[model samples]
Target chain A: MTSSDLQEQLNIKALNLLQGDADKIEKLIEIQMENLDTRYCPLYEEVLDTQVYGFSKEVDFAIRAGLVSEPVGKQLISNLERNLSVLYEAMNNKTQAAE
Target chain B: MTSSDLQEQLNIKALNLLQGDADKIEKLIEIQMENLDTRYCPLYEEVLDTQVYGFSKEVDFAIRAGLVSEPVGKQLISNLERNLSVLYEAMNNKTQAAE
Candidate 1:
């Protein structure tokens, strides 16, 4: 394969792996969103924060390594952050209702 | 550049980036080691743990994306962990001395 082909292949693989991780975080957010009626567990917030932190590190490394472009990395992270924000908003509403 | 050349260059870049991050964490450990006389800051421990966790995620991503070999990734993590353990041991000794 040509050099470009190899580069493209690597980029695709990197994006896919990153997306998979992001999906895991998204799944976590979705679970919390669905269980909004249940009492909020503080540990869940910590776990989600840690997961997102780790994932951002991964994306940063990928971008630095030339495996993924900056824009693509930003897109992946923003997608997850948007979902996380939504989950947090729902949790907040539940807390306010309880009060 | 040839495909092989590109691959080699990417591998080196990834390794260098990972080593740079490891060095930052190592610097943190060394600082805490030198300040053993000062009261231990629990915050330092928390920061170190979070940094290591994030760094591990980066190494994992690099390995998964095929930028670095599994052995190389493992070596990077183990080196940091070993230093962290040494720092912890010294901290333990200091605490015992104070008691």
Candidate 2:
């Protein structure tokens, strides 16, 4: 593979690895949020919001910079959305548990 | 206050809150990495690397957009560096623990 191809491959691999880490972080945030006070919910949510925004921007940058293909970006985004939904459910569960 | 001032103030507040969240996430990643196999360390590190890069970009964007003062951006970046150092120490500790 050419150097450009190698870079694209690395970007794709990084995105996949990032997805896995995002899943793990989501689970960890859920568990931590459960034990913390309600006041911290907004804080945690803000962090996640910033992260999601950042990740989305990075995906777009990767596509525009020709570091990754459109399909790869789309798949990464899909995984991000799925992970976010899981996070939302975890947050809801924590709220229910607190009540 | 002018609308611009209000926006800058909000940005500063968000940066401060983000700093707090970064600290928490650093701790969480540290703890999680301790239990997980060594293979996962690079994955976690990539997520963090991406995050830090994203954050630095955001900070620069904020300054360029006049959403935050240069000093405010500097402080935020400084906080980021501190948190990252702590994270590095955690990673080092994890490696030592595994040895």
Candidate 3:
């Protein structure tokens, strides 16, 4: 697959992993796949639009949804938390510079 | 203060609370207030430029840095994880709808 396609798939995979109840989590996210499906699943599109960055949301979403092993999920969340802490500092530091 | 000033102040307060070592943490983040100060504190403004969203980053950054009480930090992180999970699902569902 092309890079964009791969990105789309990974994004989808990460997202699927983040949803509720891993055991029951479906590999195929049954959203409205097209114009024909939209009538049934409108919430799908509305939510994807929210711009939440970083790793914890991705990992936590997966763990709580039951898509990943709990340990792995926790690891990802921890890593993100640490990195973002630095980034948070960096961002604030940057803002200070800007002013 | 006007709402904008309040936002700027809260944002500053949150950023200050998120930095390292609470007991030793200073309330005033001493960034270069102007051209005169810029030579010394460049990292200050650089950090605030990154666009990280949600509560966990806000709270965890604070706790790990020793700026906040651990209990309060954990509670914020928990709430963010839960809410973000729902948002992740919703976003994926939205993407599915888009297709």
Candidate 4:
């Protein structure tokens, strides 16, 4: 799946986990804010489109939409792997070069 | 970051996006089930500990727990990259071997 797709999947997984206990929902959003500042958080949150205080919608779409027929797009995950591999090799090469 | 940490982070991001719309929540869970069967989904669902219909707690904790002081633990996302890289190499190697 594309990173965007993986992202959506991850988002879906997160919301499926929250289940509106209010307390837990509150806690989860708090962490989300840590990564996404208030300005950014709302923009992402807008995906779900509830004036509700917690849970982001874009993330949920993956789950609601039945994304599981596919875990992540094969190519997207593959590209992520390739990018990482390059990063890993570069880091290793740099270290060896320095050594 | 560890896959688990990334898992948590993904979960957090997911919840932060949902913000409690019941219809969205329902759709989200349904998609979630596509990936996680009902029995598994609920078990994961219980992570949030809400009698509520949607959202999983384990996923939400990443968002709520102030986990951002760190993002997916660098090593985790990196490892995900590594594993994927190996798969990439192995697939290529097999194709080359076949040729």
Candidate 5:
């Protein structure tokens, strides 16, 4: 393979790994969303926040290391954040309903 | 550059970027250690923990993405953790002395 081909392969691999991590976080959100009726778990929020923070760091490193472009990295993070916000909004609604 | 050359370059870049991040965290520890005589600040601990967590994530990603070797990535994290532990021990001693 040529240098460009190798670079392309590496970029794709990096993006896939990041997407997989995002999916794990998304699954966490989905689980919490499904269990909205259960008592609100602060620990879940902390874990989610920590996961997101770690993910952003990974994306940032990928960009800095040239494994991923800045635009692509940022988009991945924003997409995850949007989904997270939806989860938070649902949680808030559930809490208000309980109150 | 050849494919192998490109790969080697990326590996070095990834390691350097991780080291740079580790240095930043080390600086944070140094700053906190210098101010140990001042009243203890829980915020510093929180920030340090968060930074270390993020750094570890970056190192993990680098390892997964095939940019850095697992041993090298883990060593970078352990070195930072050691310094962080030293800072925490100093803080604990200071607190005990004050009491």
Candidate 6:
């Protein structure tokens, strides 16, 4: 296959990997929040925040480069934002509970 | 700082990390090539190829998004391409020596 075709395949593979990792991270965060251990809360928040930020940037970059379609990029960004919000709220609730 | 500034900072940071990692990976590959162990040659080539491809796409995306300047992107790409060529030559020589 041509380089462009290879890039397209890599782009799809990257998107899939990002989505799968996001799902796994969100589920892990949910479980951690339910358990609500103060010690691990910060670590969980850090992981979620870092991964969401990094992945969102990757999606944006892909869209800008025409590696992925705009609609697909938008959807990926929306999902990531949703997950981020959930993580933020969980962190906030934990903080309030601790106070 | 504005979001644009933040993105610029991230772009710089990412570029530095990529360059540093590329340097380290290249050094490792050189050492491995010197040793000429068939067992690890495949693994080293795989790492170098995958990283070069991924980082080149990232540089392209950053340029398209205006996150990095064109000259800077061009320099980065040139460096990566040079490293890749060196790796290819090393691998080819190894194959020839074995044959």
TM-score of each predicted structure versus truth? 0.95, 0.39, 0.23, 0.22, 0.97, 0.43
* Candidate lDDT values, in order: 0.91, 0.61, 0.40, 0.40, 0.93, 0.64
Docking class of 1: high
Runs in model 1 deviating more than 4 A are: none
User: Which residue pairs in candidate 5 have backbone atoms (N, alpha carbon, C) closer than 3 angstroms, thus clashing?
Assistant: none
Stretches of candidate 5 above 4 Å error? none
Q: A1-99 in candidate 5: lDDT tens per residue?
A: 999999999999999999999999999999998888875686887799899999999999999999899999999999889988998899888878878
Best of the candidates, lDDT = 5
Q: Compute the lDDT of residue B27 as modeled in candidate 4.
A: 46
- TM-score preference between candidates 3 and 5, better one: 5
Better of 3 and 5 by DockQ: 5
- Residue B36 of candidate 2: its Cα lDDT? 54
In candidate 1, position B20 carries an lDDT of 98
Q: Using DockQ as the measure, which candidate wins? A: 5
Estimate candidate 3's alpha-carbon lDDT, on a 0 to 1 scale. 0.40
Worst 10 residues of 5 chain A by lDDT: A37-46
Clashing residue pairs in candidate 1, if any?
none
Q: Per-residue CA lDDT of candidate 4, range B1-99, in tens?
A: 555665566555544444333334444445544543223333534322231312332233444433322344333324333433444354455557758
Chain A TM-score for candidate 3 is: 0.35
Please count the clashing residue pairs in each candidate, in the order shown.
Answer: 0, 0, 30, 40, 0, 0
Writing each residue's lDDT as its tens digit, candidate 5 over B1-99 gives: 999999999999999999999999999999999888875687999899999999999999999999999999999999999999999999988878988
**Per-candidate DockQ vs. reference:** 0.91, 0.04, 0.02, 0.03, 0.95, 0.04
lDDT of 1 by residue, A1-99 (tens): 889999999999998999999998999898888888875686888899999999999999999998889998999999898888888888888889989
Native contact fraction (fnat) of model 4 = 0.00
Instruction: Give per-residue CA lDDT, model 1, range B4-63, as digits (tens).
Output: 999999999999999999999999999999888875786888899999999999999999
TM-score per candidate for chain A alone: 0.94, 0.62, 0.35, 0.32, 0.94, 0.65
Q: Clashing pairs in model 2?
A: none
